[model samples]
Target: MAFLIKRGSKKYPYITARVRAMKSKLMPREVYPKLMNMDIPEITRLMGESEYKQDVDELAQKYSGLDLLEHALNQNLARTYRKLLRISKDEPNYLITEYLRHWDIWNIKTILRGKYYGAPAQEIMDAVVAAGQLGYRQITSIANMESIEDIKSALANSPYYSAIADYEGGELSTIENELDKIYYSRLLASIGKSKGEKLSLKFIMTEIDLKNLKTLFRTKKAGLDKDVILELLIPGGMELKSRDLKKMSSLSWSDFLKRLEDYSYWSAISEVVSEDMTSLMDVEAVLDKYAIEYASKVSHYYPISILPIYDYMLRKNNEINSIRTIVRGKKVNLPDEIIRKHLVM
Candidate 1:
């Protein structure tokens, strides 16, 4: 709806300038190497001097150790993303807002899972990233709900409500799958009427292709019916078609690999599948890396578009995951090599 403002050829100098400055301030790859070796306090101290200073300082008293690190990271990510939303107005802002809505889907799913597992409200609250369309109060209220049904009711007005409410069973997977579908479906649908926007089209198509490939591999492994797989598939992928997926579904595992050989993701998928890996974790990591790389490239071409903000969001999420992986690995004293393998970077 924000795309109703058609200021074609208008230069968003203010927004683009601000974003460029922020992009320059992101922690460099070299910084990660140094941080990886620092103790918790040292990590905190180092971060205090960076853009994360205010967040780290604000959260320091109440939380220490991993809690402190996580809170600061989440807060910083939220602040950075919210800044982008504030600076961007009109069409660009709308696209960024739509993408950030994924965080709402994320928060909803996290709350539902937490309630289903009977996790304490505080624990659920800690896991949420308040960087989406959902207001802080809404997330807090949802987090405090005692029952999964209450959580569902709280989300009745959310974009996910329609899709999630359609599930007949109380299974958490049903809700989760619906959430995933809604996120992707909305993402594809929000490309606006700007069929000429190359950057936007590329971002959506690449995302769809990555997701479709993941779904195909997982459904094949689970020995699910082709119809069910198709049901799970999001439309509008650049390379994947319903017919291609159907054909792939009928082939033997080896034959399926052969079929995918000519596809763009074939190399990555081939490596994982050939090893007889049952866990889709590695495949997911490969996809994450690829997605990041793709976004980075798009940002280079369309710096003023929503691509950079989305790239930054993806990188921030990856950074948190990478840090968590490192911290947990160090806590358990896993070999650095093993920990490195687990990281998406």
Candidate 2:
């Protein structure tokens, strides 16, 4: 694996060529306009004839309509991500796999929340994406556990167990925060030595900064104290320091806007604070757009690196999310303008 990874730079021309080919197959912006006019079954049929064909066909027997769409999307994402891992066998593969660990965090949170909400075990299992190191059987077992404590015990042997176990009380917020911290900590830990991997490190750090900023902004909007906000804020952002976040957390809304004025994130932060955008939803929209733009720029400069793969993955995920949003919005009879606003395009 190390040998293959070390040779990746030389092999990069080939790898990047393949990635570009795959990237070109992605649904274009024009497709969405036509898709918006189609019914659910028509949409499924359209997808069946496209890149999602095999997944759609395989899942056709068991699921239909939205369930089918969701399952196909999940399977496609998992398959594509796993293929990336298989192709790039060394450091690049390791870095990509580490990033995919977010799915592990996602799976854990889904199981915990499903248990908390008393969802059916099968339903919880259906919702999980088995793209991480955790096997499907382990996730199924976790889902089958009768109580949250039993689920926590199942996770006890995993890296997230210790952080999650410390929150003995049944506060979902505490458990969730611990999970967030563990995810980000693991991300930084996986970076290891960063001397030659500045592009990868910068991309990951920028993501962390955006995530922390979103969390802090939400906490402030909710009138939560600095300590509470810090509890959820991951510590490894590149540009935003803990002390700076602490200071921002302590400010009044106006003061917070002032503090962010000189920062790179000033424009977005100002929009949220000055416009009194009470909802974190809009703030999150801007963050996603900003992150995508930043990742796109990084990938353009470092095409041979993992940046392109990361950018493609992010964009693909965004595309799936946009589709899901459109389907749900249509189902709810939301105006097209409102739905467009909800989209991250």
Candidate 3:
């Protein structure tokens, strides 16, 4: 749910057109296949020729190989998201910003994980995507913290303060879960009661459902207790209700898999299950692929709405991941086929 107050003004036409244009300029599908066949330097050269050329060139002086590529991709993603935020206004602004809070979750999670492991501030900062409400300064401040307690103190005034407060010095996964639940609950609450926000609502719920599915699957694989798993599942998903998750958590993995066949993700889940019912990687790959296809479908179905903006953001994120996979795979001399399997597209 987003807390966007509509001003009785409409500017979707302008924003939609701009987003569509941006979508068109994204690297075409064929480019991925070509990049898969390239060596690390060749992939770098290719990025140097693409829209990320500026980032590649600027970062090239300080880093090389996969490191350079990853840093460049992070910078490029942040830049693109900021540009989208700048273009947004009214309802679109609210919708896009709500979606972008994803980065806030990402930044906070990165900070927490880094602190948990005692990672260097620069290493944590490298992973921070300053595309959310939290700017680079705020994220940097959090990253510089010496401990989880210090990080929580820095975010004490934010929405995550209460969530982080309860989990101070607690398990990383618990803190991450609290952050997610808080983000989604507040988002839905902010959307309030409005027919106009229907599409955005559906979109967020779909995202939540997918995430819950992943979490449930992982927990089941780990042999976690039914009640523990149930406690971790997020509410407000489109199809997966609390009662449904609780029931699923109580069942065996095989029974849980059978139950999943009743949902929209059944087709995608079935493909991976058929391939290797025990392979988490295969299951995750199918899930990510379905997410891309679903987002694409939603974007096209509501071309003039705020969906395309979200669609662009997801696709851009996938691109960054794809590029990182390609570069990292090439650096390790992994086969193109294996590299392709790791990609979302």
Using lDDT as the measure, which candidate wins?
3
lDDT of 1 at 148: 56
Give per-residue CA lDDT, model 2, range 77-150, as digits (tens): 87888888788756667787888888888899888788778789978876788777687788888888887678
lDDT of each: 0.76, 0.80, 0.84
Q: How many residue pairs clash in each candidate?
A: 0, 0, 4
Which candidate would rank higher by TM-score, 2 or 3?
Answer: 3
For model 1, how does the per-residue alpha-carbon lDDT over 133-162 read when each residue is reduced to its tens digit? 997788999899776567668788788898
TM value for model 1: 0.88
Between candidates 1 and 2, the one scoring higher on lDDT is 2
Off by over 4 Å in 1: 1-8, 166-170, 195-198, 222-228, 267-281
lDDT of 3 at 4: 52
Clashing pairs in 3: 1-187, 1-188, 2-190, 2-191
Q: What is the TM-score of each candidate against the true structure?
A: 0.88, 0.92, 0.93
State the RMSD for candidate 3.
Answer: 3.5
What is the descending lDDT order?
Answer: 3, 2, 1
Task: Report the lDDT of model 1 for residue 6.
Answer: 50
User: Candidate 3: lDDT of 170?
Assistant: 46
